[model samples]
Target chain A: MKKKKKRLSLMRKRMFAGYLFILPWLVGFLVFYIRSIFQTVQFSFSEMSMDAINGGYTLTPIGWENFRYAFLEHGSFKQTLTSSVMNMLVDVPLITFFSLFMAMILNKKFPGRAIVRAIFFLPVILASGAVVDAIAMGEMMMQGGVSGQMQEMEASASSAIAFDIDYLISMFMNLGLPAKLLDYITSAVGRINDIISMSGVQIVLFIAALQSIPSSLYEVAKIEGATGYETFWKITFPMVMPHIITNVVYTIVDSFEQSEILKLADTTTFDMWNYGLGSVFSLVSTIVTCIILVVVVGFIQKRTFYYN
Target chain B: MSMKKGRIKKAFQDPYQRMLLGNDIKKFALTILQIAIIVGVCYVILSPVIGMVVNSISGDKDAYNPMVFIFPQYPTLERYKLVMLRMDYWPTITKNVLYVLTLTLIQVLVCSMVGYGFARFEFPFKKLLFGLVVVMIVIPTYTIKLPLYVTFRNFDPLSIITAIKGGPINLMGTPWPMYIMSLLGCGVRSGLYIYIFNQFFRGLPKEIEEAAFVDGAGMWYTYFNIMLKNASPAVITVTVFSLVWQFNDSFFSNLFLVSPDIVISKKISTLASVIANEDKILNVTLQELYLHAGIILVLLPIILIYLLLQRYFIEGVERSGIVG
Candidate 1:
């Protein structure tokens, strides 16, 4: 129809406008992304040296030596990479579940709800590299008790609570779980604070998803005489399914990107001037991360129910 | 006999009352559990912060004293004084704050435009372009830092600037790299912000925009006057996130800024290292105290910002489900 043609022209106009709007970012993407990715790959395979002839460095192709060094020569590089990937495998799910659970709890009507929400979000504010490092340092001081003085400080400070963690550990030891499993559990326990801190953004994301769910859905379930538990399963759970995937993806990328081991790679490249080796580490890590993301997304996409 | 008869009468009088009594006990038990969890978690979160504060104020003698647990009897600002003298805290903080604020502002404007583009229109390669945006979000900045560093160091993309300048211009140890990245929507997490905005703009009703179109407003006008006015929540979210992230971003800042007065996160790290290495006169415990003081100094601005904007920050986050 003539009307349909007219609408098509309008769509074309809108598309042009859209392109115009995204022009700056497009320019940036062209300049930065494609070029950098190419150069990164190039740098990974070459010996980079300062060129006095020109201002910038020159790359002489060295083949797969950088990659080989990263894999074969650097002992800790492979170890850290594997361990970090393993950590992400555990951390991503744990963070997603923890955030979702906490979000559900915090979404309920409670006294001091605002304060509780703020408390949960306090981590996002304190998520600075400095603060994280500082907290880690503080923990080290506590655990190591750097001096006799620090030991006194700890004893006086913690004397009131007396949780008797040793007793709990001993009891768990007696339960006959394998030693490796017990070690994992203990380390996980130690990492609970880190998990809690990292989950702040995910928790907020889940909370927002929870809030946007139509109250009418809950009312409909209630009218059918659904209990609180049934409503959660039948309504809340399905509605928030997509956000779960988002949180999982976000958490996975975050863990991999910010892992302590990746930081070591950064220092190696930039600080130690091991550009070739560092690029290999960076490239491999990026590939591993992409693989994990694709796998996770594919799995989650099957379960994600898009209503609209 | 009278007591037994009374009990039987009371039980017979109201089954509803008996149910209410049972409910009260359940509620009480639930409340106890809630309180315990909340208190425990809060303590775990706050303990390090408290430690920093306590150590910052505590005298050297207090660290040795078994009796001084929370506060020092002779609280002193000596550690803070040492940190201030050594770190040049004020100049560094001022520069860091200015840089973060300006960068945040630029990112908010640039990214929202990019977001609006993705959200509002159908274009060729739209899917592919947006996919690239998603890739930008996924790939860590460290991976590309080398190339980015070279790109900025040369100060030319496609050699146009080099052609103009007759040679490459080195821009290391300067703010141009950050400025250029932010202006072009390639700053830290710029892609994420664009995605957030794109999602938000898509969620907005189309009828209002159509009305603006009918009123003869152009796309830019509709976006600036109509869409932006209604997109305050998204703006707030982006701004807060950009601010916090930029404030916390030590890695990139450290890589770029070779100047004396750099961002707080970088400054704190360097100061901690310097103190750890340089303080021979101070005991191990006192050196630790000074480091803690330095940490507190760096955290003060961010903590203040959070306190001031807590309400908007909460609303911004609560409304960020559009991204989800």
Candidate 2:
């Protein structure tokens, strides 16, 4: 009875220590996260303009005016939001699947695997906003450089390549593929390079998950005379389900945040000084992304089998 | 029938030929397919980087030449010189290096503490608090950008300072926003790091901590000396991740580090405009070669760091304890 009481006290002490450690995060959550969320919602419904006299923002209450403008008056706003959603839907699955496939292949013992893995992971380093912006600027300047005549030659050369691409695309179209399907396929083919770059983190995460699965499970399956296909479904697939959820959640957030159309909203708000309208744009996109995340993650969570 | 019999006899005579008839042939085909994909993807990821390098060194005359794509015909340091002069690389890089290192160090220490707290101990509302951390990871920064900006602009927390000063204290145009956020466990990808650390700590055997508890060591002593010493893998993982993220991060820095020349990213961002203005004044024609060279130069440090720390970084990724 005395020992039990001591154990209970020890537990209480440990709990106290836990709160002490997390105190900073708790304070931050209140000060930064929750407060910021409320402010965003409030600012979206208000008119905020900078006062030149004191370099301060003057806010006038305007009920849903920004949101009304975004939904009804702002033509490009709705279009951009829809296109961003569509892009996320398409990009997420492709990225997740491709990363998993690559991770599985790279997990095997093979010649030059280390180099291949490094190549796959290189994008995580280069995907920084600075590098990406620099590359974008460089490409723009390269095309818009002093040699207009040279650009003309390059354009013609690209057009020649385009003709061959069109020919190959037509071959698929000849098989009675839908026009939309053909377009998506052609675009995806063009962006195959981008897909590889974007999958670096996901591939790394999946490879880590794959490596953590005990080999004993596989050995057991083999002893049971399970084929490779069966072992994958019964063992590897189930084992990696939690990682799948993690990857899916990651991919969803990443795609929505970095979508091309959403970047338009960024330029519109910050660059064009339409802070109210921009807030509405961001809030709407964020809400949609959250809805998708809750649905997908909840669904995957139900299926995930936890070992511990 | 006679020809079939002859073929069977030949197959029996040559075991190597016979091996190709069924599963062996399928395995061979699968191996070829796997290699093709690995090589193809590598090429796709590599070509742009290679293109960047090759074009950065090509002379203006060669860069304009239609025939020069992968190879530089007349390699010269002219573009590099122009880029170096335009970017003011040395001072800008040094400043950014200092900022990244300092910020990264703070984040690594603070985030590890938070993660350890969540992972190793139990407390009231622990589940709810950790859920908030997960939400922090999920919610896009844009949703909170305005409020965060406002909060930083005022530079007051919990309204205590506001009550004292009777006005907003502006922290804009200073590094305080980054320092505060990082210290508070709300910096860039802090949630992810905390999550990684939490997973790692959970995976560690409980016996080690139990042993420490029995040895009459205080929690701080155990955590600082024993627990941390045993957690070298997680430390390396978190450090590399924090350093890289902080270095690459421009979103928060762009908002707070409003000084155009304080950070490398900020400088790179304004490079085009700076050059355009230079063109208007200096009468020197600016072209894409300088821009390409500048981009390569910006990426050079990161590339070097990654290559140097490849072993530790890869090990971190492989053994981060983020398993199902």
Candidate 3:
């Protein structure tokens, strides 16, 4: 009885230490994240106006007007939101699978592996902020002037290649593959650049997952005389299941960050100076993303195999 | 020739030898396929970057020339010179680097502490707290951008500033908002960083901490001396990630209206128009060349850092305990 009491006291002490350690984050989360989120919801239900007489702005309660404006009245909000969500739905799985495939390849030993890995991760830097913006601007400028000629030149250059995508499609059709599957494949191929650029971090996560799998498991499969294909299904696939969830979550969040809806929100808030409507845009997107995230993560969590 | 053919036929008839040859062929074929896929994907990734590099170097004559596709006929450093001068490249980059580095450092420290706490101890509301962390990751920054802006603009947390200074103090234009957020473990992507560290710490064996406790090392001592040393892999991953993200971050910088000198990326969006107006470079295509040059300049420092750290970064991720 005395020993149990002593152990309980120790547990309490450890819990105290835990809270102490997390104190800063707790304060920051409540003060910044929660408060801001609350304010955003509040702003979505109110009208914000500048107080020229006073120093700051004021929010007058206006009910569902802002949300009604967004859903029913706004021209591009619904279209942009649906398109962005559709893009995420398509991009997330493609990125996850492609990253997993690339990770498996990169995990193997090869000459110039380090250099190839560096090149693959280049998008983590380049696709983020200023560089991508500048590149887009430059492309837009070029399109107006020189890109027409450049596209023609590219057409000729690509025509010199012996293998044609059209020929491949025809061959696949001759083989009687489903047209729906073929359409998906062709679209994925078209978005190959976006897939490659977005999958860098996911690839890293998967490589780490693959690395952490115990070699003993493979040895056990080898002793059982399993083939490479069997080993992958029985061992490698299950071992990396947990990371698939992580990568999916990451990919979804990343896709949302790059989505058109967020850009629309930015323009609405800062450029158009429509704070209430801007809050409505962002809040709706966040809620939708959160729902998708919860449903998907929960589904994956149910199936994820935690080896350790 | 007949004797050699008989010998070869006999060798092929051996099951072990046949299997070995088949395996070798399979391996070789797979290697060839892997190389093709990797090279093709790399080209898809690098083509635009390569285009930018070519455009940045091409002179006015090459810009207009239809035949100049991949290579420039009249390559020059003029665009780089002009962009560098106009962007005030050196001073701006210096300030941005310092700001990003400071934020990265604070994020690493604060996040690891929080992550360690979540990983190691049995605390009440741990589940709720961790759920909040996930919420942080899932919630769009745009959802909170305006309120966060207002919060910092007023700068009266708990009305302490009001009580002390008689009213609110504006932190909009200063670096304090970012500093405070980072210091308190709520900086850009801090939730993800904390999650990573938590995953890493959970993967570490409990015996290490037990041993430290047995030796009379307190929690903080054990954490600082033993666990943090063993967490080098996580540290390297976090450091590289934080550095890169913070360096490229425009969301917070723009929301706070941080001075252009302190956030060089903010300058990049307006660089073309600035050049068009100031240098009288009215031609859009030429302005684009200068913009590309400016982008390359911005990318050069981060690229150099990435190259320098690439070896360790890759190795660190391989060893990092973010398996989940």
Candidate 4:
């Protein structure tokens, strides 16, 4: 009877120990992350006071005007959003194809594959904060007439492309139905840069997944007199489908830099010092994020999750 | 059948049979195509970085030409030296970085250790606790920033041994805020490392622990002595990831530290802040030097760590299935 009582107490002690292990994260989430979201949502519907005179914390509650401004009034917000998304559309497919294509090439026996891999991987290093900025600075210097070689080329190139999106839009309008449709498609693509840049991480994930497929599967296919194309579609492609779905979801989660909605929220918080407004904007973005997860991930999971 | 025999004969009769086994002619063609395509890929993707590296080392960088060839006629390390000094060499650079990293390690350690306990042990709300861990990932940084700000602002909770650190310390400007945040296993991303730990720890073989149990070892003893040591690869992966990530984030660094002025304007001096404020970068011929210095300072740790633990750290992140 005493031994049985001791065992019961031991179980209780072990349970407490388990809680202690996870305590730091639990404290962190409660204090900061989870609470912040809740606070933002609470603050959203209220009108915020920004009176510099009184230095009061917040004021009366406001309504849906903030959302209205973000969605409708701000042309710059719209432009930045379109540009980001457009860049993503072109970027995601192009990056994925290139990285995978390059990985396949590197995986093969080659004299200079290592050198090539090193060169390709250099961008990841360079893209970090300071290096990228320096690089940008150098480009600015080059364009500002420091370079003897590039001076004429920069001039000629700028003249040729003239990169005016509005002008291109005008040209599309002239092209009639087909061009207009193309323009619509491209602009629609341009709204989500988050998807594009995040594709880099996904590309790496896919490459890893591709390499994991047993060469034995391909060997078997080849034994049956199968061609490389058939092996790719049947064996290599299907095996890596799970990875593709995971990477896509991962990309959406990362969202890298702040989105337009988040940016608007930042302006409210930091720029205007309207914590209430900022919080509301954030709540809305978080909701948007959940909706995105539901649409993209939910669908993908239903289709391909059986492989898991 | 005769048809199959005819097909085999036709296959044997083909003149271009060398293509199948990488015959020199076909291999040569493929190699050439691969090289060309690879070059294009390199050019499009790496131009900015390549351009920067080339331009920085170039003797004629005063011309600031982005299209210079790979080799500089007059190579310079002058920028390298200058950039290093400006980025705060000692405690601020190394100290802040190291402090945050140590915090991350402890955070991950506690998290995974706890995670291991929860995964393998039976406790109240075992399922409920695991559910919370999953929920932790989806929570955004913006949500907790204010409450965190308040928590860190609370002097008593954080300031028990104020004299211990020789200042009336609040958690805000120092590494404490970052430390406390990472302690919970949430870095820049949504609980990536902690999630990784849970995912990885759950996969560890249970037989080892069972043996420990038979030997009458406590769960803690089995975990630390047996399972923890056995889980070396994952531990390495999580450590390297948390180290690299916590080190890289400028956002929280920007958020946490208010300059002595303790205003938003002053706090805006984090590396990201400085980069964005272009007007502040003194545009003397010194800009090149400053630019070079900044890149070196930012990249040196990464490059140095990459070289020193090149085998372990890089492979760890890659194997952990995270981006390197």
Candidate 5:
């Protein structure tokens, strides 16, 4: 009885220490995150106006008017939301597949692999916030004068060397592929830049997953006379299944960050100064994202193989 | 020559040798195809950056000349000099770098602590708390931007400031909001950093902790002296990520209205307008050349850091156990 009591005290002590370790984050989470989320929810249901008297804004409780405005009255909210969701649906699978494929290739022994890997991760730096904005600004400015003509010439030259998408579409049409599948493929090709830029972190995650898969498994497969394709199917794919889910979630979140809806919300609040409507926009998107995330992650989690 | 030809014929005639030769040829072809694909993708990724570099160097004559496509007939450093001066590049970059580095350090420390707590502890509501971390990651910053901005703008915590100072403090246009957020482990992508550290810590054997306990080291001592040192992979991963994200971050900076002089990324956006107003060089195309130079200037420090840490960063990611 005494020994059990001592053990209980020890457990309690350890738990206390754990809480101590997490105290800073817990405080921040409660103070910053939870309060912000709560206020945002409250804002979505209220009208906010500048309080000239007290200097801070006042939130007057109004029912679902903001949400109604967002859903029914707002011109671009619905379109942006749907398009962003659709983009996510299209992007997630493509990014997952492309990153995994790249990761597999990158994991192999090759000369200048370090350089290639570094080059692949370049987007994580360059395609991020202000750099991309600045580059786009430059590109927009370049589109008016001599550079525009130069760009046209360069595009034609590249398309001549590269297989034209139009030619490929015609060839595939003659070969009688499904129109929907062809549309998907064409869209994927069109957004190839977006896909490559977004897949940097996903590729890193997949590479980590690939590297963590024990070489012993592959040796055993080889010993059993399995071919490369067989070995990949039997060992590699299932082993990396868990990371596919992580990458999918990551890609979805990333896409939403870059989505038009978030930008619309930003404009609504900061530019338009419609705080209630902006809150509604963000809240609806967040809830939709949560639903999609739960559904997709739940689906993937079912099939995810946990090796240990 | 006759003997060599006979040997080749003999090898070709053997079924095993023929199959081996065929497999080798297939492997070689696959390798060539893979290289082509990699090279193509790399070119696509790099082309825009190359374009920016080329444009930044192009002289006024080259900017207007239709013949200068990828390369400039006459390259000049004049645009860079003007941009550097107008953008206040040196002072702004130094301030931004300091801000980013400090934030990165705080994020690593606080996140690793929180992650270690989640990873090693058997506390009440542990699962629920960790779920909040996941929620933190999932919830877009836009969702909370308005409230967060208001909260910081007023800067009152539980009526403490309100009671003492008779009103709330406005933290907008200052670095305090970012510092406070980071110190409290709520900075940009802090959830992801915590998750990485948690995953890494959980992967470590429990034996280490037990041994430390047996050696009479307290939890804090063991954590600071032992576990953290052993978590270099997670540290490096978190450090690089935090640095890059914080450096490129416009969301939080914009939300808090952080001064353009403090966040150099914010300065890039206004560079063109600033140049136009200050220099009276109102030509959009000419102003664009300066903007490209400014972009290159912003990218230079980050690219340099990435190059220096690329090896360790890649290795860190591989071993950080972020896959789970």
Candidate 6:
């Protein structure tokens, strides 16, 4: 009983220590982050548009109204969301597989590996707003920012179908299916190009997780006459299951929080001020993301996670 | 003090760390893959940048093909000069460097202390508070811009340098906000940094502290000698992370001090913002110069720091909670 009491006291003391240590972060976060999130939701509900003067909505609240605007008034909401998801569909998997692959490869021993690693991770260093802005400016000069040249390119390409050249592909076009699908796919790809550029950290995380796997398992597998593919299946895949869940959740959360793109388009539509709508959008996205995360993480726990 | 000579020797003898860090066939393939992936990744990341540079440099009057990746057949430095004259690059850059340094240092120290406390001590409300930290991990900092902007709008930059704007006390459009942010360890990636420190410090051997306590040493003494010494890995890691994250964190600085009142250099405008705002940087004739200059200016500090801290940064990343 005395030993039990001592153990209990020690546990209590350790727990208290942990709490005290993390206090500053907690206070700062509540003061800064939480209230802002609350405010953002509030701001979303109110009508806002960027103007020559301070760009914002003249704050007002209209319940479930912004949803209507997003869904009913502008079809672009669904389009952009779909486009974002589609981009993610391509971007996330490509990033994950490639990063994981790179991570695995990097985990190997080789000469000049440090230099290579630095180069690979250099993007994380370069992904600053400064770089982004510089790149954006550079694009403006070459692409003419938002000039009609791009539109002209699309127009010219579309017009290509009108010429004698049309005869060769006329049968394919008349089926009407391929043209529409191709056009839609191109447009969708163009829409979410911005989000695809920001997967540097995801790559790093995949690499780190890959490194955590023990080599003894591989050696054991080698002794067992296991092939590389088999080792990946039986060892690597199971070892990094937690990272998969983490990446999925992180990607979803990031996709939602970076609503800056939408917030821009919102400026033009529904001139009414509504913070509630903005908040609602954030809340809805976050909720959806969280739900997806919980389910996925839960499933992962059951199917893959093993107690040590 | 019980120095782990045995452990140190064993660590030196440890084949795994040496094997991992040292060169071998596995490392060679990884190095190649890294180079390839880096090239691909860099191209994507640099494409828009190359585009921006092209846009800024092109001699075209009404419209330059910014996305033009082909080297500008006519590269010019006129835009660089224009941005310099227009943006007040020297003063602005000085201010930026100073601001980043002040903010990073304070934040590092505070975060280290707080992280140390969390990792080593037994205190109250530990789990709940730690949970709050975890929750803050996902909590976006941008959400607080409005209120904090309001709160700090009246405050002043703290006592730092004489040449800086906003006096020794201006918060509105001053370095003070970023500086204060560091003290709280709440900058761009400070949350993660704190978490890193926590994890690193937690891994520390408790025997050192316990022995210190047995000797009637105070908390500060134990912390400085035992915990801090043992926490070289964490410090190195946190410092590098802080440097890099603070260097690149354009979002918060842009949002906070983005007003016109800010002097050209001390402000948080980075290459990304300059590129984003290329049209306004200088007139068309000097666009090319601005492009190259912007890249140099924005990247120079971080690049230099990165080079200097390369080994340490890698060390930190490795010592960190996760990933190499």
Q: Against the true two-chain complex, what DockQ does each candidate achieve?
A: 0.37, 0.42, 0.49, 0.27, 0.48, 0.21
lDDT of each: 0.76, 0.74, 0.82, 0.55, 0.83, 0.57
Q: By lDDT, highest first, what's the ranking?
A: 5, 3, 1, 2, 6, 4
Ranking 1 against 3 by DockQ, winner: 3
List where candidate 1 sits over 4 angstroms from the true fold: A47-58, A65-79, A109-115, A131-190, A214-226, A260-264, A267-274, B1-13, B17-24, B78-95, B154-174, B198-236, B258-262, B270-284, B313-324
Per-residue alpha-carbon lDDT of model 6 for A224-266, expressed as tens digits? 9997789999988876765665565556545545554345334
Q: What's the residue-level lDDT of A40 in candidate 5?
A: 80
Please report the candidate that would top DockQ against the real structure: 3
User: Tens digits of per-residue lDDT for model 4 on A1-308?
Assistant: 99999989988887787777777767766666566656666676666665678764664656876667666875565565555444433444444554455556665656655455545444445444434443555556533423444555446544544454456666777777587566655453442222223344444445445544545566689899987778877876666555555455454445523356567767878788767656655665555555554575567645552222
What lDDT score goes with residue B166 in model 3? Answer: 98
lDDT, candidate 2, residue A94? Answer: 84
Query: What's the i-RMS of each model?
Result: 4.3, 4.3, 3.4, 6.5, 3.8, 6.3
Which model is ahead, 1 or 6, in terms of TM-score? 1
Off by over 4 Å in 5: A1-7, A51-56, A72-76, A143-146, A153-163, A173-178, A212-227, A230-235, B1-10, B150-173, B200-234, B257-261, B313-324
Residue A92 of model 4 has an lDDT of: 40
DockQ class, candidate 6: incorrect
Candidate 3: C-alpha lDDT? 0.82
Backbone clashes in model 2, listed as residue pairs = none
Which pairs clash (backbone N, Cα, C closer than 3 Å) in model 1? Answer: none
> Model 4: per-residue lDDT, tens digit, B211-258?
788999987788788776655544654554455555555557656773
lDDT of 2 by residue, A99-182 (tens): 999999998879777677778877887888787887666555544233443455447645765776688798988898889888
Cα distance off (Å), candidate 6, residue A117: 3.5
Native-referenced Cα lDDT, model 5 = 0.83
TM of chain B, each: 0.81, 0.80, 0.89, 0.69, 0.86, 0.65
